[model samples]
Target: MTSPFDFDRELAELGAAHLLRRRRQVAPLVPPMDLQPDQEHLRGTTYLIDGQERLSFGSNDYLGLSQHPAVIAAAQQAAARYGVGATASPLVCGHSPAHESLEHELAALVGLPRALYFYAGYAANVGIVPALVGKGDAIFSDALNHACLIDGARLSRADIYVLPHRDLAALEAQLQASEAPRKLVITDAVFSMDGTVADVPALLALCERHDAWLLIDDAHGFGVLGAQGEGTLAHFGIVGQGGVAPEWQGRLGRLVYMATLGKAAGVSGAFVAGEPAVIEWIMQKARTYMFATGAPPMVAEALRAAVQLILAEPWRRQHLQALQRQLREGLQAAGVPWDLWPSDTAIQPLVIGRNESALKVMAALDRQGVWVPAIRPPTVPKGSARLRISLSAAHTGEHVARLVEALRQAA
Candidate 1:
């Protein structure tokens, strides 16, 4: 007879392995009694966990635009004007002026001919991959790519080769060996867990030599990298104020770029920008975009305001970089046992190696009123569990200093 399902036993095994996960209920900052009434109205950077306020270092609100007055106001206005939901799929009656305008703005921001919006970053990857290639095609992906990209490659029914993380030689070899009719190279512009950026220009070169399509998921780089916040492409000097480099400008047709709004943009939803024809193809064939109810029009409006803020305020990115530098330098000075993964970005990961050790450090930090989440497998490779410290522009220097001191005491 077939064995009966045993969730209890499986859960017990996971617990014994120290890989089980739990969620904590958290409330955004509540003002202290000593603060004035006007100051009380201002949101703080701490979170209340288990009835204790803790300084948060585990959020992905990199630019801290999530609580911006303009973004919130725009959302309110759109909700009043358009209501709460789209109520239909994009292909049906769901498309709105807000969505269209956001799409146009995103394409321009990313220096692409057209763009297609999705409900989330995961949806964009899962949907776009299959829409582009399948069956006889081949997909070259990075070993440490986001789960969504891995899932997308699997779902495509294509020949999948996962190259070692950031190994350009391996990637090139795979690309060269593939004889499939359509070849696509997909990678994250920033590896989320390790917090290191990919060499996009080099990847583009390989793709060009191999005559393969290059898709870069710049979710982490979008609002934080470029001078004008144009994302990884701009950071590489491939595209700038004038436009894409002349030599590579014509190759834009084969390049696909995606960025999610929830991270740096401080909103929800994601967009894929590329050649007009590629977007048109995705619109018709991407099932996730076709079958799912469209994202709320209000969200699209809020995202438009977010894009404007990203472009208008360069100081947000500057302040964020300063905070990152402060945290890194402070940690080094404190001589903490755990070293952060080499990353100049806002995502500074302190690898704790073993799962139990990571959990212990996380708990210790919690006791000291610092909230940094312990990230474990299968989010990262086994034996490399870490404390993922996601810095935000809103974080003060004093906050960073406090966290450093907390680390010293906790250690």
Candidate 2:
């Protein structure tokens, strides 16, 4: 009998290209191991995924608030007070006192007049883009932006220009040549893949020259960077002042900031903060905002507590920074090639040119009880397969040392 499918050769070619995907299960009773159906064992960094113990370095819970007693307690209390679900879309009665209260707290934290929440970071990006720009508008984006940002720009129906990474000159040229009715420059404050920061001040200057609005998605930077953890804008000390870019001074009000709570905040959901008119416009126009259910009240409560912990417990950030410094310094001292180790942030990438090499390294580390994952194209550029090493506050210096030792042994 003839097969129904005809792409066997092409499929095999893809496998040969190291682009195939698969999964494994975590055994019951293994701490932090990911338990998936139909598998005996797999690696994981969190102990309670399906309820097990595993040493985790793969999670984005940079501040380690995911299991923080206070944060968990807050979530429990909120669920007890508000119930298991919000019941309906925020526009249709899901917006509760919990949501409102979190919004106020987040607004104050970011030094903005208002903030609007979304169920996920991707939804927030998609909603914000379409709400702000349309058929006659334009968006200048960084080339290595997160997938959500790329998708959001595509959904916006605006003329989108992807500028070279951190190339202000090229961006200015694009802005100079464009005559779209509205202009928006969007970027991830920290590139998730490479862990590099965006040049916000330079972008702000370029925006002023062309009367464009700037949107900084601080998904990775939000709860880990800046004084008081306000994010990249504050990290660079450019948010509150009005004189750095005189042409953009008062116009700084047009700088829109959006961030996810799932990373350093160790919670779920995202929000956007900006001028009253812009937010009001989104409330009235963004489909995700108007149609989707609000973030769960309990998640908001957890995030509120997470934010407080980030601010009150500055040691978490300090610890994370120190860990990064130690890891970088130790790796350098050990003669690990710097060219292979890119990223100053906790999201260190141990570049392995071949996907199989990266996966092999990951397997070797996993056998030693570490859990960094192999990232390959198309998630990254071709020939850039890497072990994406993410650090968390929950980890100790000893943990970092162990990973470094494992890398040395693997090498």
Candidate 3:
């Protein structure tokens, strides 16, 4: 008889395929005693792994606000006052003033009337999708949407039509043919792995024509795009200072905008913002939110501070853009022999085309004190394995230059 599980065989298969994933134990940077009082408060961007300081190009701290003194102070004050845990689900007694204020701020920033917080982005998507559509309903999803959205669609038990990545024609064809009573179109604002942005205006127009609801998970775009970091909608001028334009207001009832805090926001948790009634419905229905304990109040407070920083510090976004240009130009000038994906965002992929080759390049970069992870199947498609170089405002020109030189040498 076969054993209950074939764990050993699975492990061997994964190892042979060069698909095994591992975690690196990293140490946070500490300020040197020799630094001045003001300088000492600045957060160091480098991380120590295996007793070596490596210039990390894998972080999601886009604006470098994770260690900002104001964010830290806000977190500290909240933790001291509210302790480290909510100790109950939000529906119970877990909802705190911090959570409430953060939700309001997030809703305002995204130009939505209301917002509901969740423990994380994964939970938010999983909860919201199922709450909105199920059984006889239909969910039109992008082929390359994040796993959270995919899982949510699966859990909803709806007829899921995964149109080819960014193929608006295919999506429209499906929308035109679907007979389901409720149709929902879900997509990521920024494709996380490839870093390509979705055309929100086009999607909204399609949704309107088909009488469908649009749910955008702007996890990577929030705090990294637009003049005020309002995300991809603002990047496309679909939303303005007065909020989503009056023309788009008719579809606002069905627009569900979700974003994660842990990435560009430099904090924890996630939120779903939409019309008041839709948000209220989700609050009453999303199982993940109803069952799980609320995120710590301190994290919510820190996120509030992060929002303020994202709004006030426009220079940070400008500097990040500069770094992006520097890296792209340097890579082109160096003539590195890899297929670089076209992306204007923080994520830049150097496609190596084979799993082993991507791994070899990553190892070579590691030897040169540059830390960029090798992205392989099933994170990306087969025959398109790559080195995902994630940039941040914390990185400098020198850091980017060093990375370019290392890539040249590695290539």
Candidate 4:
């Protein structure tokens, strides 16, 4: 039977390469909260369970609302009112008032004509792309776009031109030679691994000149950027540019934005805001939305509350920026080798040259009661493994200091 597929050889090679991942089970915490003396797991922002403490500097809960009282209360109320599951797809009997309300709120938040909800960020990207662009069309994608975007583009059956990361000139050259009537340019607002913001203004400028459609996945930027957290478009002054804010009924001119509620918003869903036609087409044709079961009513309620909190609280973003600056300054003072990551947001990484070195440093930090994960190859480029250090507003000055200390020791 083909020599039993040689599973042992592959496993051995993966172990040798330091690419094997394992899950650590943790016991639940008791009162007078503390991490387990020899900790085994994590809960929310902190990395502890019983009586020990582990400073956590690696989480995407930017606003620390994942366990917020309001969000929990809202979800509980929703579960009571609408039950536990959606039970069907949106086109069936699953679309509830909660989903509809969130859509309206998101559309208003992003200044768009309409918005559609998806169960996951990957599903949102996958559904939106192929539904809009197809056989005779082409999608110009960034080389560093997330795996979800890459999968979605691949599924589109359209020619994909992967321009070099942030290379606007290369993109222009590709567009200049394009002959497709429906050319869509897809990019991430902030790259996941590098924590770098896209050159959106320049990209939008090029889109205007080329007369192409622009789609921005703001999964990493939402609730952490802009005046009121309208994401990258607002952060770069492109949405309300030149004293012209595109109203609900504005023409399908250029920009289309998609954001996920799981990170900064501290919820469990994703949404896309764009021209009415584009969203409507996704509703009708996108297989994920049409065939898959909709998100639970409870999640929709939680996201609604999360959006309100994002608008109501501005200090969270401010605290995050301050924390980022503190960490950067501390690292500098200690003479640590690192990169700025081209972002002022929560996601950050310290490049470590070798995979084994990265794993060893992460293990050392974990032993010293610090929990930061090592991001290795496949997630990043070869020879570019790093410790992906994420910051959250829930962290205090002491937390940052402890992280600096842990990094020093690990190094």
Q: What is the number of backbone collisions in each predicted candidate, taken in the order shown?
A: 0, 12, 0, 3
Q: What is the alpha-carbon lDDT of model 1 when measured against the actual structure?
A: 0.89
Each model's TM-score, in the order given?
Answer: 0.96, 0.90, 0.97, 0.92
Better model by TM-score, 2 or 3? 3
Candidate maximizing TM-score: 3
Indicate the residue-level lDDT of 325 in model 4.
93
TM-score of 4: 0.92
Clashing pairs in 4: 35-48, 35-49, 35-52
Model 2 segments beyond 4 Å from truth?
A: 1-13, 23-54, 240-249, 337-342
* lDDT value, residue 243 of candidate 3: 93
lDDT of 2 by residue, 1-411 (tens): 647685787778778987887764433243222335532222223443223345556778888777676887899999999987888888899998988988898887876778988889998898899988998899999988888889889999899899899889999999999999899999999988789999888888888878999998999998888767777777787653232233334666768889999998988999999888988898888888888777779988988899899889889888889999988887887776424456767687778888888888887777776767788988898998888889988778877898888888777
* Alpha-carbon RMSD to native, per candidate: 2.2, 5.0, 1.8, 3.8
Give the Cα lDDT of each candidate. 0.89, 0.81, 0.90, 0.82
Worst 10 residues of 3 by lDDT: 33-42
Taking the tens digit of each residue's C-alpha lDDT, what string does model 1 give over 298-356?
99999999999999999989998998899889999999899688998888999989999
